[model samples]
Target: MMPLATVAALSAALLALMAQASVIGDDGRQTADREALPLASIGSLLDLDSGALCTASIVADDLLLTPAHCALRAATDADCAWPRTRSDCREPGALSLRDLRFVPADDHQIAPADKFAHSRRIDRVVAHGAASADYRQQRHNDWALLQLAEPLAVQRHPPLRVAVPDYATIGGTALAMPGYSADRYYRDGNPVADVACTLGFVAAPVSLIEHDCDSTAGASGSPILIRDGDGGWSLIGLHSDGPDPRYARSRNGEHRNYGTPSSAFWPALMQLQRQRSLQPPQATDSRR
Candidate 1:
C-alpha cells in the first residue's frame, strides 16, 4: 500500500495528464498470484477476434460481472452522442457469443496451449446502460452481467460475495483492486493488483464511488473489494475508467477513479437470477 500522503504530491509529468490518468501520485500496482480462492476468482474478458481484454470477477456459480462498455462495439471517432444515438451503441443480442470469452484466473504471464480448456463462453449478457451513444456520459451506470455456459468448479475458485451490509460502513475504509491492466500486459496474460487504497467518497446522489487505486484500460471491469468479517474479501463496487466526459473537469481536487456502487446493480442482479430460473436448461460445451 502506498502512503496516503503521497497522493497530494503531484509531479510535473503527471500534472499535465492528471485528468486522463488511472494511477495517482506514483504507480502502486504489482503483479498478483491467482493460485488461491479469492484471487483465482479474477479473470479476463476477451474478444477473441479483436483481442481486446477487460478484467472481470466471478459473482455467482455461472455468472460474472463486467463493465457494460466491454460488451459494446469498439468506439470510433464518428460515434454519435446525446440527441443522436451513438452509431455503435449496443442493443440486445448485439454481441457475438463465439467471440466473447471469460478466461478464468488469467494470471499466467505466458499462457499454456490449454487456454481454451479453462475459458468459459458467455451465453447471455444483461446490461443496465450500454444501449445509447451517450453511454460514456453516465459512467456510474456502466455495469453489465454475463451468464456462463456452465457453472464453475467451487473448490479452486469461488464467487466473491457482494459487500452489502458492509458497504454501509465503508467510510474511510481501505480497498484493493486486482485486474488485467493492458499497459504492461503481454500475450500470455498477467494480472496487476493495487492494494491498501481508500475511497475518496461515496456520493449518494449519483450512486457512485470514487477511489485512488491505480488501474488501466483492461482493468475497467475489475472489482473494488473490501475485507469481510470472516477474513474474506467482498465486492463493493465495479471500477470504470474514471468519470463521465462532462463531469471530468470537477475532480474534487485529486486524481480519482469512478465506479458504480453495488446498491445500483444489486436489484437488477436479483431480477436476472429470477429470469434465469424460468429458462429451460440448455446444453453446455464439454471441452474442459
Candidate 2:
C-alpha cells in the first residue's frame, strides 16, 4: 500500500473526476528509451509474475529495487502466501523471495515497446536485510532487492548508478524510464513497453517527482532516470502508480505517474548489499 500523501493525491484525483464527470482517459486523461544492449545490459524492469505481472529495476549491480507491496502482491498465490494483509506475517521470510524468478523480454510485447529492447531474469530474489515487519504498512519503506543469477553483458545497455541518500533534487530535469505494463483496465491483453517525461518538484526527505510517464499493471518496478554530470543517467526512483486505476482512465490522463523518492534508495541499496554478503550466492553468470 502507498503512504498517506500518495493515497490523498489519488483520492483527490478521483474526487475531481467525479465532479467533472470527465473520465481521465476515455474522456481525456492519460498518457523509456533503451540503448541496444546485451540481454544482461537490459537491466531495468524485473518481471515477477504470480497471477498479475509486476515491474522492478536494478539499483546496484546486484541489487534490484522495487516496492515491498509488490512482494506481498506476488505472494497472494496459493503456492506462495506471504500474508501481506496480516500483521503476523510481517516478519522476515514472511514474504518469501525464494520462489521468485526473473525473465528478460526482448520485445515490447513483453513490457514497454519503445523503452527497452531486451531483458533477462535474475537467478533469485533475496529480501533486503533491513526489511522490517512494519514495512508492510509504513508505505515509505516500500522497497525490496533481487540478486541476479549473472551479471549482464550488452552492446548498448549499461548498469545504472545509485544516488547517495542526500537532499538532492534534479528540478525541471529531463528524465526517462523503460518498463513493462498492460493497460490496467484491460487485464487480459499483452503488456507494452513505453516511455515518458518526468515533470515535477522534489518533496525532500521523501523526494517526489511528477511525470506523465505512461505505465500499467506490469510496470511496478521501472527505474526513474535523470542524466548525471558525466552524461550518464543515474537511477533516482522506482516506477509506482498514478491517481487513476487501470480502467478509470485511458493512456492520456491515467498515465500521470509518481514514484518513491530516491532519498530512500541509498539506504535500501546498502542494506541489500550487506544481506548479499552475509548470504553469498554459490556462483554468478557473466554470459552475453
Candidate 3:
C-alpha cells in the first residue's frame, strides 16, 4: 500500500547514508597484512648498544632512510639541538654510525637455525643539512640516510624507490604507513600498519606532509607510501612524528602525523648516490 514516490525517496536516502558512512570509514585506520610488499620493505632502526627502536625504510641497495632525530637520539642527547639555519645544522659528530643497525622486514620471526640475512650494520650516517638539530625547524630538517655496511641481498626483498612527486599531484592520495610500533610490541610482538591512510594536508610553509595514519614512538622514520598506476608503491614521505597537537583531531581525536617529503631531500640523496659510485669496491655481505 506504500506509494512509489515515497519508497523511491526512502531508498535514495538510505543510499546517501551508506555513501557517507563509507567516506567516514575510509578515514579510519586498519592494519596491513604481514605479507604486504610495503611491510616487507620496512624494518626497525635499532641502536646497536642501547637497543632503542625506531622505524626505517630500505630505499636503495644499501641506503636506508629515517628521521635524523632517531639517529642523533635528540630526545636525550645534550649535544643535539636545533640550528638556526641549514648550514649550522650540518655539524659533524652529531651521530655515530657504530651505534646503529638496520633490520629490514624483521618481524622477529627468525628461528634459531635461520640467519638474519636482511639485517645490516650502519657504515655511515648522513642527515639532511637543512634539518635543524633543534625543534625550531624540526619538521623541515627531520630526515636522514644511513649507508649500510653491506648491501641488502636483493633476492630477499628489493629496495623501494623514493618518489619525489610534486605535492599537488599527491595531495589527496591514499598512503600506506608501515612501521614497528610499541603497541604492537606489547600486543602482537610485530610491527603493525595502516594501509588505508591518506594525505590530510600538505603544509608547504612548514615543509611537512600531514597524514591520517596511526603511528607511535617506534614508528618514527616509517615511510608514507603511495601506489603507482603500475601497481607498485613508491616512498613519498618519511613518517617522522606522531600526531601534532596543533591540528584538529579526526574520528578518534587522532591528530595528523607529519613527515618530510622525499622531494625535499632528493638532491642530497642523488649526490650521496653519486659519491658512493666513485668509492672503491669493498667486501660485500654475500650471506643471502
Candidate 4:
C-alpha cells in the first residue's frame, strides 16, 4: 500500500493543480504523433479472457511495464464461489503467467480493432502484488514487468529510458502523460496526452504523484514523462488512478490523477538490465 505521507503530499499537490485547472484546461491536452519516440514506445495490453484493454510501454526490448491491477481476471466458472460484491470473489486469480498479449496499434485505430499487428505473447509477469480480493491493497505496488515471448527489433521498437526523480530539481522539467484514455478512446484510436502538466511540489520517499492530467480506465499503466534537456522524453512514473482509496480527495474535494513514482521502481528495472533483458536504444531512436 502507498504510505500515508506520500498520499498526503500528493493530495496537497492535487489542491494546487486544481487551482490551475481552469487555465490548464484544453491547452494541456494534445494528440501524440504515434510514430514518434514516447508514443512509439507505448502499446496496448489485451486480456484474452476478459477482453479488457489497458496501456503499456516498452521499457526494454523484451520487457513491458504496466500496472499489475490491469491483470485482474474475474472468474465465472462453476467452481467459483461468490459471497460478496461483483468485484470480490473466492480464489480470485490473475492474468500473470497467462496468455496476455501485448499488441501495438496505429494511432487512428481502436486498440482491440487492430490486435494482429506486432502482437507479442507475454511469457511472464513479475510484480510486487497480484490481482486478488482487494485491488487497493496493491496500489502502491501496482507496477509489473512483463517479459515478452520474443524481443522487439531494435530499429522498429526502441525502449523508453526510465528517469528517476531528482530531489535537487523537483520543480524543474515540464511533464507529459500520454495514454489511451477510455472516454475518448472510441472516437479515434489516437491517444490523448496531457502535455506540459505541472506537479506542483512533491515530498520525499514519494511513492505516488498527483496531477491534473486527463485519464480514465484505459489510461492506467500509462507513462508519466518528463522532457529531457536534449528535446527527448524520459519516464518519471506510471499513471495509476485518480483519487483512489489512498488519497480519496483533496482539501477542495477535488480528485487528481495519481502515478507510481518511477524512482521507486528504478532498481528493479536495472535488475532486468543486469539480466540482459534490457537492450540499449539506438542513437537515432533517441530522437537526439
Candidate topping TM-score: 1
Candidate 3 C-alpha lDDT tens digits along 1-288: 234334323433443333222122343444557666566677877664444567888877787888877776433233234532233334554343436766666445563112124356787776554545454257657788887888876766577778865645455678888776654433443666777677865554556677777665677788888887788888888877654445443545545667777777788888888987899999889995
Off by over 4 Å in 4: 1-28, 34-37, 72-98, 105-114, 129-137, 165-173, 200-206, 244-247, 251-254, 277-288
Clashes of 2: 30
- Sorting all predicted structures by lDDT, with the top scorer first, yields 1, 3, 4, 2
| lDDT (CA) per prediction | 0.67, 0.48, 0.64, 0.63
Off by over 4 Å in 2: 1-32, 36-49, 73-93, 105-125, 128-139, 149-157, 167-170, 183-196, 202-207, 245-256, 271-288
Give all candidate RMSDs, comma-separated: 9.5, 10.1, 14.8, 11.1
Residue-level lDDT of model 1, residues 45-145, one tens digit each, is 86654456677879888888887777655443333455535444554434323257777873354343345456688877655553444433467667778
Report how far off residue 200 is in candidate 2 (Å): 2.3
Q: What clash count goes with each model?
A: 1, 30, 5, 0
Pairs with backbone N, CA or C atoms under 3 Å apart (clashes), candidate 3: 81-133, 81-134, 82-133, 82-134, 131-141
lDDT of 2 by residue, 1-288 (tens): 344234334533443333322112332212223342112323334322323345656445555667665654323344334432545344445554533434443343443322222434455556542344442123345666676766544333245576665535655566665554443312222233333364564354444555555554556666666667877666676665555443232233344456666665566567656866899567867792
Give residue 262's lDDT in candidate 4 (0 to 100).
Answer: 74
